[model samples]
Target: MPNSTTDTYLIGDMKNGKPFNGFFIYPRTNIWLIFDFYLNGKRLFQVYNDLLTASMVEDTETSFTAISNKNIFVNDRLKSGIEVTPVRVKKGIVDIARNVNNFRTTGFILTLFDNRSPEYIEIRPIAHGYELISTDKNTIEVTYHASGKKLVFRDLEGRVLTKSKRFNSDHYSITLEKLAYTLKYRLVDAESLERFVKEQW
Candidate 1:
């Protein structure tokens, strides 16, 4: 019920060496992307809006089609995409999440760059319809950019956390076709990144 996990966000090098990551940013209503999850036992529905709404199901390999009615957005802003990690609790139930929540979302986005060397950032739009171009290979160009900050983290015998180099509020953007990277990147849903980071702890 969503666009994709961080798994399929690669292009041009699926069968070769370690594939390159293309951080394709989904089209934003304002400045955010929303992902909705619905879990029915082993099957979980991940839905997102990319101009028009799109979705996918995860946790099973059964070849089938998933169809369900969902309200993608409540207002005109992006909703928080938090994944419930407790096995006893359903990950996608909003009401249950409210009652059983414990994780603090203060530095959530900072945790997304855990081990993935996130490289390029691509902002694309739908022209006529969805082009379904790999991830960052845009059929119709909307806007493509990325900005890397000096990041720091300790991966020792203990725990490792995503740390930002900047402590203050600062936003920067870099636009390019291909940029030289000491580290590459990944294109993913904001919520998937959130869930992935949350599970690690």
Candidate 2:
């Protein structure tokens, strides 16, 4: 069972407890978990992977962003099947893209958490040429540029959840992950993520 190479496993008439495999990307780390009936059991697998991924990384962009924002979210899917939820959305500033002094890294972070929970998400740009797009619960998309920026949160039905405030300089950007928190929150910002990339000549 340890060295097995089967892509799929079946349980309870292919319906009950078959092993499931998935990956969770956090702001600080990227972790993978595999559930199998045999090797070390399911509980051990979850515990091991969670602990492994929770290890701190040097360049933690997501954790920094989350802290800057002051809110967090967990995957809605994990709420049903998995028992553990590692900081799905950090409450801080996510660097969407940067073109500062010729260096560029373009990406976005998806946040999650309840809006009425007395906490909000934040996005801050460490470098100058960064942009943030906030897609609130209402599914309305608003783009935030460096200067002459406004903050707005809308519901999916085109109703304004909240109005946008002008922002010239803020520390972070934020959003609430409704159902897709699991799909989006898996992007972690770490120093070692660069190592996984192949070098070019």
Tens digits of lDDT, candidate 2, 1-201: 223422233331222454233211222323223232322222112111322122233436443333211011122222111222224223322221111121222332322223332122222243322223343223323333556334345443455556532352121223322211212122323322221111100
C-alpha RMSD values across all candidates: 20.6, 16.5
lDDT, candidate 2, equals 0.27
TM-score result, candidate 2: 0.23
lDDT of each: 0.25, 0.27
Tens digits of lDDT, candidate 1, 30-114: 2124233322211132233322112122424321222232222224222333322221112221100110113223111111111
Off by over 4 Å in 1: 1-25, 29-73, 82-105, 110-116, 119-154, 159-201
Model 2 stretches astray by more than 4 angstroms: 1-4, 7-85, 88-142, 160-201
Q: How badly does each model clash, as a count of residue pairs?
A: 12, 18
